[model samples]
Target chain A: MNTHLVEPEIVMAYRDGQLAAGEAAGVRAHLETCAECQEIAASLDDVSAQMRAWTVEEPSPQLAWRVAGRAGKPKGKFWWWHWPTAALVTAVLVVAVLPWKRPPAPTVQTGWLPVGSVRTSESNLPLPPAEPRRHDSVAEIGPQAQARTGQLGGVIGGIVSATPMAAPPTSVQRRTQAQFAMEARRGAAIPVPTAPMIARDATLNLTVKDFASVRDVVERIVRVHRGFAQNLALTYQAGRNNLTATLRIPDPELDRTLADLRYLGKVDQEAQNGEDLQAQHVDLAARIANSRVAEARLKELLANRTGKLSDVVEAENELSRVREDIERMQAQISSMENRVEFATVNLRISDTPPVPAPSSVWRGLSEAGRNGLTILGEGLMGVATWLLEYLPTLIVIVLVFFFPVRWLWRKLQARPAFRLPN
Target chain B: MDLTGSDESLMLEVKQGSEPAFIALFERYARPIHGYFRRRMGDPQRAEDLAQETFLALLKGARRYERRALFRTYLYAIAMNLLSAERRRAAKDRGSTTDEPATSADPDAVLWVRRAVEQLDDQQREVLLLREYEQLSYEEIAGLLNVPVNTVRSRLFRARMAMKELLVTR
Candidate 1:
C-alpha cells in the first residue's frame, strides 16, 4: 500500500510549510537525524523544483480587455449590454416594489399532519363534526381537523402539495426522488387490482363572504364525503384572505363533495378531469409478467445449471436487473391504482372586504386624503425603484470602462492624435 | 482595499466593483491560472482562452461570492471545472492525445518533467500540480477539491514520489 510507500502527512506538511512553528521545529530536528525522512523530504523538494522546467507563456495583453468586455456582456458583444434589459427590469421593479407589503409565506413545520388513515382505503368513514373557524392560519386549525388534515406523511410528499391560488393549477401525485428511493427499498409492491381505473381530479375556485368559515367548511365537507385534506394552507391578506387546499376524496364521493364545497361561496370557476389508467395498468402488468419469467429463468440457471465462474456472475447480474424491472413496473402500477382509488379536489376560496358606505362627509374627505398620499408615495417610489434595480449594473459598467475611457479622454486633450503637425 | 491586503478582502472590493482590486487579483493569479490550463493541454490558444474565461466567470459571479471562502480557491475551482469540460470535449474530438504543450527551447528537461507529472494518477496529478505549479496550501486544495485534508496530503505525497520515480527513469 502507498500508506507506507512515502512519509506520513507530517513529513509532507513539513516540506510544504503547512506545519505550525512548533511542529515545524520538531520536524526540522527530526529531519536532521532521520535518514529515511531525509530522503523523502529530498524527493518532495526535487520534484517541485524539477516541475519548474515546464513553463507556460505569459498570456497576450489583449486577454484582459476581452475578459473585461465579456464581464459585462455575456455574449462577448458590446451591444448586448445596452439599456433595454435594465430598463425592463426597472419597470418591473417599479411595478412590484412600489406596493411592497407582501403577505409572508406560511412558516412551514408549525402544525398538524394526517393520521394513519391516508395509508389505507378508509374512505367509508363518516365526516368528522364541524367546528368554528379560527381567523388565522392552517397552523391554528382544531386538533380533530388536524387529525383529518395537515400531516407530512410519505403520501403527502408524493401527492398534490398545497399551493397558493393565482399561481397555476397545482400538479397532483408528483413523487419526489427520495420517496421513490424509499419505496424501492421498502419492497411495497402495490397489489394491482384487476378492475377498470379512472383517476379523477377537480379545481373549485369560489368567492366567499365569510372567509373564516371556509376552511372549516371545506374540512367538514371533505370528511362528510369520506375524503381527507391531503394538504391545506390558508393565507391572510389585507382586506382579503385566501384559503387554498388540495383535498383527496373517494372516487364515489367526488361529485357530492364538489357540490357541498360550492355551497360555501359563489362559484367563479370549476374544472373537472378524469383520466383512464386501464391501458397503462395493463401495459405495466404485461411488462412485469415478462420480466418475472426472465428473472425466474435466470434464478433457475444460477441454482441448477453448472457453468463457469464468469458465466455465473453474468447470470446473477442479469437476474438482479430483471428483478429491478419487475419492481419498477409494479411500483408504477401501484401508484396508478392509488391515484384511481382517490379523486383529487383542488379547493380555493377567496374573500374581498365589504366596501364601506359614505355615511358622513368625513368619509369622503378621509378617502381623498388617503388617495392623495398614495399618489405621492407612488411618485417617489418610481425613482427609488429605478435606482434600486439599476444601481449594481451601473456600478459594474462604470468600473469596467473607467480606466480606458479616462485614458482616452486624457490622450485627446494632450496630443490630439488625429491633428496634423501644427 | 490596497494591493497588500489579503486576497479575500480584495475580492470583497471586487464585489463592490473596484477595478484596482480586480487588477491586483488578476496580476496575482494570471500566470498561475494560465499555467494551470497550459500544463494540462497541448494548445496554447485554448489555454489562453480558458484562462480568460476564468477571470470573466469570476467577474460574472462576483456578486454572489461570500467572503468566508479564500478568493484563490474559488478562482481555481472555476478553472478546474473549465479544464474538465475542455478535456471531455478534447477526448471526444481526438482520442488518446498527449498534453505535451509548447515549451521553452530546452525540450529534453521540460518534456521529461511534463511526462513525469502526467504519469501520476489523475487526482494525484491534480494535487501535485496545484502544489508545485500553483503553490496552493494543503487546506486550500482540500477545500477546492471538496475532499478531506488527509486525502489531499496523501495524494500529494504519493504524487511527489511517483514524479520522482518517473523523472529518474527518464
Candidate 2:
C-alpha cells in the first residue's frame, strides 16, 4: 500500500463524512489496508468519542424553578406588533398633512417689517441721547442715576452691606457708601490704617408681613450692631412690595443681625460666604507705597527739568504716567479700605402673601369669548387672510390640474357603452 | 416508525395548545438537548438551564412555527441563540482585565477537540456543530442558517481539517 495515497485530511474527511462519494470510497479502500491512515482514523474517532463523553455538570436544581417561573410569565408582544400598517400610514400622513410652513410674523403695532430687517445694520435705530448733569462729586452722578441707579445702587448696596462682607477690615467695601462719600469729600484726609474688617456673608430668603417693618428692623439691627446699609432698594407695587437692602455689620454683630432677620420671617434659603483678604490687602498696600515713591520721584524730576526739548518731553510724559499710576493706587486703597470697613449683608424681604393675578383663567375666558365673537362676525377677514396666504399656491395648483381634468372629462364623455358579448 | 409524522403530529398537537404533547416533546428531546448544551457549555448547570430555556423557547416560538425545518433543527437553532446570549451575558458580567480562555474540565483529547472546533471561526464552528452533533445534513444546515449549501460543505471541510490537525497534535 502506497502511504502517499492515504492522507490524514482525507482520513478525517471520510471520518467526518465530508468527502465526495468517489473520494470517500478511495479513502475507505486505503483505510482497509493502510495502517497509518487507519491509526489516524482511530485517533480521530477516539477524540470525538471523548468529546462526546465530556458532559456539563448538572446545574443547581433550583435553576429549574427559576427557569420555569421565568418561562411561565406571559410573553409580551412587542409594541410594533399591533396595527403596524396603520401606524406606518399614520406616520406617512403626519409627514404629508402636517403643515411645515414657516411661522407667520407676529402682528407688530410697531410696524410690519420683514423678518430679517432687524438683522440689517441699516435698520438699527440710534439709542436715545443721555441727559447731562452737574459734576458734583456725589450729587452729580446722583441726578443722572437718581431714578435707575439710585433705586439700584443705594438700596442694592444697603442689602449687600447688611450682609456680612468676607473681606478684611481694610477693604473699601467695609466702608459704607456714606463714609466713602465723606472720605472722598475730605479729599486730603489721611486714611486711618486699620486692620482689615473681615465679614462673612450669608444669603437667606425670608417671608415678611411688611417690607417696611423688615427694613426698619434690619436698620435698627445694623445700628445696634455698628453696621450700615451699603445699598437699599424699595419697590412698591400695587399689592406687595419688595425691599432688598445690602448692609454692612460688624463681624461681632453678625449673629445678632441674623437673629433679628430670622424674626422678620420664615428663613427659606441661607448660605454664608467668607473671604480672607489679609494677604490681598497687604499686597495692595505694598503696591500703593511703591507707586507713591515713583510718583514723588517723577514730580521732583518734572520740577527740575532743564534739558533738551525731547528730554523735557520725555520727562513730562513720564510724570503723566506716574500720575496715572498714583491715581490707580489711590482707587485700589479706597476699595480695599471699604471692603475692610464694611461687612456686606444682602437682605431680601418679600411679602409673605402672593398677589392675586388680574384677569385669571375666568377673566381670560370671558375676554376670549368677546374677542372671538368679534373675529367671527368679521368672517370676510378670515377669508381675506387665508386668500392672502395661499393665493400664489392656489394659482399654481389651478394651472397644474386644469388641463388634466379637461382631458379626463373629454375621454370619459367620448367613451361608448360596452356592447354585450355576442 | 414514521419519524417525520410522529414529530410533526406531535408539534401540531403542541401548536394546538396540548400541554400533554408539549410534555411529550420535552421528554423526547430533553436529554438530547441537555447533552447538546452540555457538550457546548462544559457546565452541567448552565447546560440544564439552557436546555430548559431551549424548551421554553420552542414552546413560545410554536405560534410562529411553520414547520420550515425539522423541529429538532429549529429547536437546536433556538438553543444556539440562547447559548450565544448566555455567553455574551457572561462575558459582559466578568469585567476582568483579561478575558478567560475557553476550556473544559475534560481530558486533553476532549479539550483539544473543543479548542480545535472553537479555532475554526464562527461560521465554520456553527456548520461543524450542526453537522456533527445535531447530525444535520449540509442542505438542511444551509437552509436553517440561511447560507448556501456549497458554503456549508466548504465550512464543514475546513472544520474537519482543523479538527484533524488538532487531533493529530494531541
Candidate 3:
C-alpha cells in the first residue's frame, strides 16, 4: 500500500462515481490500500447519511383536495365563447386608440381673387326713370312759339296735350337701348385699349444681415420711386428682427424698384403676379354712362311735372338711386385706375441667420448642456402630460383586470409543474 | 385506471384534460413535494401551502407541458422557485432588519443538519441540499441550477467536505 494517496477531490469524485473510469479504477486501487483516504470517503458518506436522517412529514390530505378542487374548476381550458369576446375587446381598444393616433389636417391659405372678376348683376343696378314724352299740343305749337314763350309755355303745352302721350319706353328697355348705343359708340370711336390694364403685385422673402438697415433702404427706394409703404409691421425676436411691408410704386418703375431692392438682401423667395383689369374697366365705364343718362332723364321728368304728383315723387326717388349707382361706378373706376397706375410689392425681410456651428469647445459644451436641460424639462412635461392623458384609462384597466390577474397569478404560483419561483 | 404510465404520459393525458391522469400525478408527487418544502421551511402550514401551490401550478401549466426533461426535475424546479419566492417574501417582511429567525421545524437531527448546511455559502448549500435531501443526480443538479456539470461536481464535493467538517466540530 502506498503511503502517498490521491487528493481529496479525487476521493470525493470516486465516492460519488463522478470520476472518469480510469481515474475511478486508480482511486479504487489506491483506497484498497490507504486507510486515511478510506476514512475521508467514510466521512463524506456520513455527512450524506446525516442529512438524509432529517425526515419531513408529508403534506396534509386536505391539500390534495384543495389542489384538486382548483384543478377541477376547468382551468387552462380554451372556452369556445372567449374568442368573440376577445375579438370585441380588441376592436374596442383599437377604435379607442385610433383617434389619438391620427394626425391633424394642415390648413391652406388661398390667394386672393383678382379684382372685378365677379360681374355685378344687372338686377343690382339702379332703376332708370320713365322717359318724358312730347305732348300733342306741344308738338302742334311751333318750336319758335315755345321758345318765345319760354320754359313756362313749354311746360303748359306739355300738360295741356290731352291725347295720352305714346307709351313711354319701360325703364328696362330704355337702359338696354342706352347700353346698346354706348357699345356701338365704343366700337366706332375709341378703339379698346390694346395694352393690358394689369394690376402688378410682387412678394419678396428676404434674408438680410441687418433688418433695420434693409428697411431704411426700402423706405429710401420707395421715396425715390415716388411710392408709399403701407401695412408695415416690424417684429423683434430673440435671434432676429422681422419686417413685413407692402410698398406701392409707379407701374412703370416697379421692375426697376424690384431690381434695386434685391441688392439689400438675399432673396430666398420672390413671386410676381399681374392681373388684367381691361374687362372690369370697360364694364365700369359703360355702367357710369348709363347711370348718367338715367339721371338726366329723371331731371327732365321732374321739371316737366308729367303725370300725377305720385309720378313726380317716384321720379325723384329714381333720380336718387341713379345718383348712387353713378357714384359707386365712379369709385370703382377710380380704384381700378389706381391699381393699374401703381404696382404693389409685399416684402418680408428677416435678419436672422441660420444657427452656426459652435466656435469653441466650451461653447459647444454649453450648448449641449442647455439642450440637455431643455430636453429633460420637455421630457418631464411630456411624461406628465402622458400620465395625465392616460390616467383614467390606466385606472380603469387596473380596476377591471387587477383581481383576475392576481387570482391567476396566485393559481400559477400554486401549480407544481408550471409555477415559477418568485 | 391506467395509473402506472410514465410521468410524461400522465402529463400528456393531463394536458388532454384527463382528471384521472392528473390525480395519479398528484398522488405520486404530493408527498415528495410537501416533504421538499417542509424540510426547508419551519412552518408546516406554509409547507403545505407551497406543496399545494406546486400541484396547482402543474395543473394550470399542464396545457403548456413539454417533455424536454425528467418530470421530477421539472417538479423540483417549480419547488425551487416557490422556495425562492417564500425567502424573498420573508426578506421583504424583514425589511431594514438584519436578523433572521431560525427556520428549522425539528430540534434534533434536522436542526443539526440545517446548522451544518447553513455554514456553507449559498451555492454550495443549495448543491448539497439538492443532492443530499432531494437525491437529484449531479447532472440533474447542474441542469436545475443552470451550471456546468463539472461545476456542480466541484461544488457538491466542496459542500460535502465543509459539511463533514461542521458535523465533526459540533
Instruction: Identify the candidate with maximal DockQ.
Output: 3
lDDT of 3 by residue, A1-422 (tens): 54565877678878877778998999999999888998988998898788887777656667866775455433344332233344447545754675563222222212321111100111111112212322222122244433433433322222122112232212111123345455543532212445678888999987766554555456544643446786678997777788899887767667766765665556789999999988987877777777777887888988899699998889989998987887676567556766777679999878757589999999999999999999999999989977776667656655566566566656653554321111
TM-score of chain B of each: 0.92, 0.82, 0.88
Candidates ranked, most accurate by TM-score first: 1, 3, 2
**What's the TM for model 3?**
0.41
Q: Kindly report which residue stretches of model 2 are placed more than 4 angstroms away from their true locations once superposed.
A: A1-47, A58-422, B1-5, B42-47, B87-105
- Tens-digit lDDT string for candidate 1 (A36-111): 7888788877878888877777776666655654454332233334344444555555555555443333332211
Q: List where candidate 1 sits over 4 angstroms from the true fold.
A: A1-9, A73-422, B95-106
lDDT of each: 0.69, 0.59, 0.67
**CA deviation > 4 Å runs, candidate 3:** A1-11, A25-43, A57-92, A95-200, A206-352, A359-422, B1-107, B115-127, B136-170
How do all models score by TM-score?
0.43, 0.34, 0.41
Candidate with more favorable, higher DockQ: 2 or 3: 3
Instruction: State iRMS for model 1.
Output: 7.9
| Docking quality band of candidate 2, CAPRI definitions | incorrect
Model 3 chain A is weakest, by summed lDDT over 10 consecutive residues, at A115-124
Query: Candidate 3 at residue A226, lDDT?
Result: 47
RMSD of 1: 34.9
In the order shown, the candidates' Cα RMSDs to the true structure are 34.9, 28.0, 22.5
Error of 1 at A4 (Å): 11
